[model samples]
Target: MTSDTEEQEDELLALHSIFGSDEFVRDESKSAGELRVCVELPAAFMVALTEGETLSQYEISFLPPLLLTFELPEDYPSSSPPSFTLTCSWLTHTQLSALSAQLTDLYQATGGAVVLFSWAQFLKEDALRFLDIDTLLELPSGEHSTQNCSQDSLDVALSEAKNNKHTPATGPTDIQSLDLSALSLEAEQTLQTSEIKADYQDDQSKQISKEDFLNEGSVLLPSSSSGPLDESEQGAASLPRESPPNEDQRLSGRSLTPSQALLSQILIYDAAQQQKQFATTVFDCGVCFMGLLGMDCVQLLCGHIFCRTCLSQFCKLQITEGNVQGVTCPDADCDAAPTPAQVRSLVGEELFSRYDRLLLQKTLDCMPDVVYCPRHSCGSAVIWDKSSTAAMCTVCAFAFCVTCKKTYHGTEACQKKKKKIMTENDAEQPTAAVPRSQEGMKALWDDYVSGSKQRKRLLESIYGRRSLQNGLVECLSEEWVATNSENCPYCYSSIQKDGGCNVMRCYWCKRLFCWSCFAKLPSQGYLDHFDNGTCNHFGSDFFPAT
Candidate 1:
């Protein structure tokens, strides 16, 4: 008994080895030693309804994997059967129930032998065939029709098996009796009617074939037939007709019948499948550590596979950071770069536009003769030609000198304009005519006092005394304006007396400014600037007198 148990355990382990550990799970909750296995049905066995067509490759590959939970009994193979449950989300409850019942029937038919592996294989390869499911949408609505059709198919299969004489007679009987009681009376009647029709058609086919062979000599002369051959006879006669003169048919020198066309399509499909199998391979992405199919991954020239998602995200990060040239392979040691097509395919259209723009800008930056428009708001590229020192922006139509980077001066060399500006600036500078001393300082003060009295009288003659006094006060305040008062850096409004702390906000511009240096503060409120060295007066009063 112990040897038998060990053998059963060994068989279960061997099944696990064949399927892989990823597909099998050992359940500890069941003290009886249960195993949970997941199985993905083959693409050919799965079906779906899409766009009014019943022949779609089901989207089961995208759905959750099917799970089979089963427990082994102590004397499983010899006397006791395994206990199991099948779970799937893609199928409806009724479909699952039907499948579960059929699975149980399959196990019972094999008696007390080990049937877990057989059950798994059946569900993976033949579950849809056994369930009479052509498409997932047909499951719920065509239950009655499916029952009748499946019964007819079963009868047909049994008939073929019997005619072959190699199949065991009892096998057909066992299958026929397994679930016949579950079928409704109407379904059974329909199945019988279909069988009778099939038999009549077979007889008619044999009779027609015999008649065609006997009348072959007469058919050679078209005048033998009375009126016109039937549709089937006309089709058969057309097979020997001259081939169409089209280039495609002329290559083979023969026209293909429906059967031949279907066969060629099958051959082409098989070739495509072979190519697909050879091309695709699996690999784990270096960045995200996710398993991805070869088609869904982008392999760098350095031979590292990065999943499309991670590669796109990396490219997007680099492009958004204005590092278009730095969008290379993610590996630190590798310097391989993605091609423009690869980058365009990975990142979407909007981000690719930014990438393209930056790439063009970088290319222009390396050229010595290319300069952008001098306008601050419109910085389109402007190409300088040898004919002229100025370049006109194609986008904004702004013409500028390539040498001085300023508005174009007609027919004047940039060097001459620059020299003239330098000479005029030198002439405007104040000069020290004598040596510096107290006497020179007194002489300057006396000249300033007389100049200011004359300016006050001139201002009073031009305006009124009140306006003159206000202007004079403003001018006097200008001497200590930097130390005593500050202007709002944003709008340059003079802030004479602030009521709040050193971190003052401009009422006119509604922007934060530091009272000490009158520099603008961030919009995130007042306290952030003090910590960042932008403003030093964190706790000081707004207007501390000098």
Candidate 2:
């Protein structure tokens, strides 16, 4: 037969294999071998309780650690069983008693076989199911109160078992009532060492028996009595108890209330339908023209779908290059653009902020009545009334003209000020002595040329130099019209008598007019006007020589 020491080593090795060495704590100061351990309930059982419900922090706090203290007897496994005590903060006294009874029964059923490992495994894996703890609220109170299981209960039993030197391990007796003292010296020294803190104690005032909780006729109370049931707790009672059909067929098929059953069926159908739809779906990306799953593709408002990878890359490229407006549907002919929310979802927060700012700036730039402060130090956008010509910057308090984007001149038009500058420059110019008529004409021409130059410079300062140069080209276009064309008296369109008779028709207004005096002519033609001698220079050049 194996010696007790060798058997103890083998049992400990087995426990290490099952629970890991970190979970097994041996007291170094004790010659009578003793160990303390902590274990978690299995995930398969926890999932059943948590399914279809979002647990709050308070509800999750009730999941306390299971602490066990055990001592090895000197006798062989063939004659004696290990003396053990189980304690938990989240289970009531009756629940703990029931668990102790079940554990004792399990050991006896094995005919005095070594059963500590089996007992730990059962408590870790099957205790929740055995006690029907189907929800978080059904868990025992976790408040500080006298009803909590005292650690002294376990210590007293351990002390008695240690004193009874001849006590046999094999007996039909109540383990809860059996005051066995089999703890080692180290355990006796640390009997009160692992006491639960005051805050960690269960709220015994709200404690309910397991029977009352599981009873169908009893109305379950909230976890606290200080107030009525909250929305979560009220809805929690109606939630269906979901478990895999194969794992526990009876529990899985347990009948739900009418409303709960309908909800369960709806959820099942929606999940199945979505799975079927997605399985059958194939998305062809518009950008890369690659086939992908429905989930891999993003659909724009234009009803065009592209793979998320391609769309995200497209958006990032456009935003990086400051081409935010170009971040639209990739289709060559489509004009649809993604919304701000869509861009945010695709490009992430940092890049989306850039895109949004660029988009807003572009929009403000297009508004005629909106102008950014001309001061480079304070280039904040400012809005003016459409009818007003100036605006005051809200941020910098800088007043500026909306038209010229210069300093604001109240009640004065920017163009009127520019014209006044040109007139003043002309008045200051010195006139050299010359013949009377010739000098007057020469001075007029010189002043006209100087005035044009001054106007060009003023426009250049208001607009950019390049923009003013383009405007000069347009302004010079009027010269061509003045030289080769005469204005239609009716519509004021410059009508060029290009190789046609003096009876000219305005292309814009289509009315007949005399090229000589620019007067509306009879419908008959210029021949009738000449016949009546309405104006001179009929047969010759219609416009008299200037």
Candidate 3:
């Protein structure tokens, strides 16, 4: 014959194999265990707050599970049933008492057989249906001390059913399923402090209301027009009257309602479960097009997934090419960039450092009040001063004028350019000023014109506003003439070629020249220049039509 201990061991082993660690826990030494029974929700059921004037409903796919804790006695299943408690946050005290009675009745119907699994199945699959809650579950307000009442009823009902053999016990009123007495000393102290704070808040709110009422009603009466009131009238008037609490005060001191508290628990549980499912599932990488488990891939902030190897290679290429901006989502339609931490994980510290440096440089280039130190060896960033054109490099201790990019010379015209502080050998060499590239000049001009009023004024203070205006006009004129005409080789004056073949006459000098080569052509045989292969009479090299 099978012993009661053997039957208990076999059932526990089967349960451990069926449920994951998240749902079931067993205490082998005490012959006790706990199971979290997650009731199945229907397709479109809603949960709502019961006391609100406006209906506040939420569509949820899952709720926090009901905790069922049980302990088996020495007697076999043929003699006695397991002692247990069913606890949930969303159910009312009345509902909990009814369910506790039904569970006892279920054990009686089982005829001394093991009824643990049967009760769990009933809670998971048919609890809501049995309670006649088809579409919605309404939660009570904070005014209901439902958990205390439910605890008492549970104790009475279980004690009567077992004939005082054993009584069921409940846990606290949160998502956790541990006895309140088992809480740590620190947690108990925290609870006490929170209660004291709540009481203080209530007292402060009442005092503020009383003071406001007295200020509004205590107006001085003129002795000539009105006689003094009796002592009873003054005493009655001094007593505080009831009124609605201030909106800000009410919100700051108000505790969450029971329905709100339960709703928050349900939402938190649903999100956690969804994340756990996502982590273990398989997904297709968007970049490499490889099917891989989520543990081997990376999910970006934009919700795109790619294998780590592919993302590493992509980021490495971007950093190598100095195209730091391209280190973003590989999806053509999405422009979301990976976070610095994610990028660091993929490309490693070395490449991520390079990416960080280049990104910072690009950002500083866009700011009007930032510039780089002129020393070639130490190209550190320097913050520009609004009051003066001179800036000092914090890294190299080099002070230079911002406008001319040379050593600072206070109130003096800028000198001829010298070689940038490169090697110590080249630092003192006198070098011609390098002309700015077309792109560099355009970027600088854009920064000056499209900058804020303060930035524009700062630039104007350093370089006179009239000088800057003339420089702009000169830049525009040079661009226009360079596009429309050629310059005279001798006088350096612009000469437009309107008509005639390859032969041109400068209006300023009356000198004949080959329009194609701009070579000084002889007045007698100016057409001879085109006869040679060096120049073309009607080739695409002629000035573009206006």
Candidate 4:
């Protein structure tokens, strides 16, 4: 026959083989070990919390494991059962106690046999159903685990005190009587003196009544209160009361219950488990058409999976080519895009920065009330004011008009510089002869350039690409003339200075003016006008002395 030690060793070896090292650990010195049992949850198991009329529910796929620490005696399965302790975070003390008692009963029913595996199986597969937590588990509100722990400690202390036969039992009333009987006359006298001093220090509204003093004195020394204490007590009968909790405090008092706080931990564990499972699972990449573990794959918003290498290269190509809109899922039918964090992870910092800039520009371009600062080097986004014609770039501090895109001229009309190709034709026609419809179309084109993406699309749909190109050409031509030439102050005609003196003559109006000051000058004595304090004869920017 095999000895008890041999039987115990054989049982432990069998458990180790069944559970593997991850779930079971054995001590070589003695018949002892620990087992971690993860309770299997049903597919639709839900956890719910209710506050007033609002009910919130969540489905959890994972929970923290229950720990079972056990130590076996020399008698082992031949006589006594294995001594074990089962512990879990989500279960109450009463529930754990019930499960512990059931485990002991299972041992007794086994009639002297190894029951460790049976206990483990019961905890893993049947604990929830046995506890009658079938589909939904309702968590308690307004109850803290600390309060329960403190209460349990108090109960244990009371039980120990009760079991001590040497000490006499004392109720609260009896204890108070004993204390009163033990007090001396000197302590009473000192207490009365302290009360008198407190009366003087406190506010007048809080003054103590003679009855209150005498009544307290009577409680201490009953012999002194036989005379007029009854009449004084009747005269001042008000008592202090507790202040009520305010509305805000009352509402926020239950903001985080014990169960709700624990639910956050539970959800976190569930997420970690899900991620671990995903990392180990194999997935087929949609783009590369290769089988790979989830750790090497990227999952897009549309639930399509692709190898990280393929997705990273795709994003890099799009960002490098300045096609930010095309940096989305490669699925032809889907338009799902990667999140900014995912983009950052897939691509390095330099490429991500480009992607971020292009994305921001595209987003800003779609807004009707947003425009870019016209400075080529400092092209920062500026919020356009619809009511005002001028906008100030917060970045570079350049104040320019929204209409003419030139320096802001408050309450002044925009300087509309016609294209060089149109100047000759425009000069042949009268000012009033220019079509109002054409003027309106020009205004519309200006608006379309700075308007929202929807407005641009609508305009394009109505006028077609040819009209847009013509408007763009006109805008570019005007912008070029505005940058390269100055207006001839008299006729308001654009004039380029190709190495000349300060005195200028308008080609259309024949009016000579000081180019530096735009001041009209006498045709014969134009040189004298350059001697003014603001103008120089040699076309230098430096002004002459007055």
Please rank every candidate by TM-score, starting with the best: 4, 3, 2, 1
The residue pairs that clash in candidate 1, if any, are none
Give each model's clash number. Answer: 0, 14, 0, 0
Q: Which candidate has the highest TM-score of all?
A: 4
What TM-score would each prediction reach against the true structure? 0.31, 0.34, 0.47, 0.56
lDDT of 1 at 117: 76
> On residues 1-546, what C-alpha lDDT tens digit does candidate 3 reach at each position?
368777777778888798877577776555667777889989887877756576667766777677666667766466656666555657765565566657666766777677778888888998898888888987665432223112223343444434532222321222212111112112211111010001111221222121222223222210111111222433211111111112122222565443454454444455444455566989999987889987788777788989988988998998766778899998899999888878888898877876786687567767878876766555567999869989999999999998887889887988766765555333222222212555444444544554445455545544545445656546656877899977898687898777656667788988887776678888786666777658887766555554
The sequence of per-residue lDDT tens digits that candidate 4 reaches over residues 74-138 is 77777767766554556654556556656766777888788899999999998988788888877
lDDT of 1 by residue, 216-326 (tens): 211121011211123343331111111111112111445532223222222232333333442497779889899888677877656777998999999999976667888
Q: lDDT per prediction?
A: 0.50, 0.51, 0.60, 0.60
Candidate 1 — number of clashing residue pairs? Answer: 0
* Superior candidate under TM-score, 1 versus 2: 2
> Candidate 1 or 4, higher lDDT?
4
Q: What's the lDDT for candidate 2?
A: 0.51
User: Which is better, 2 or 3, measured by TM-score?
Assistant: 3
What are the per-residue Cα lDDT tens digits for candidate 2 across 1-546? 457657676777677576644345543333122222333334332211222363312222113334555656776355555655555434555666566667656756776467777877887767877777654333211211111222334555456545654322432111122212223323431222122212211221122223232221122222222211132433311111121111111214453322222222223423333334544589888888899986677777687889889999999999876777799999999989976666888899988876786677667666766666666455567788878787999998998887777788888767644454454224332123221353333332322233334333432344444323333444545666789877789988777765545667789988887777777776765566677776653446644433
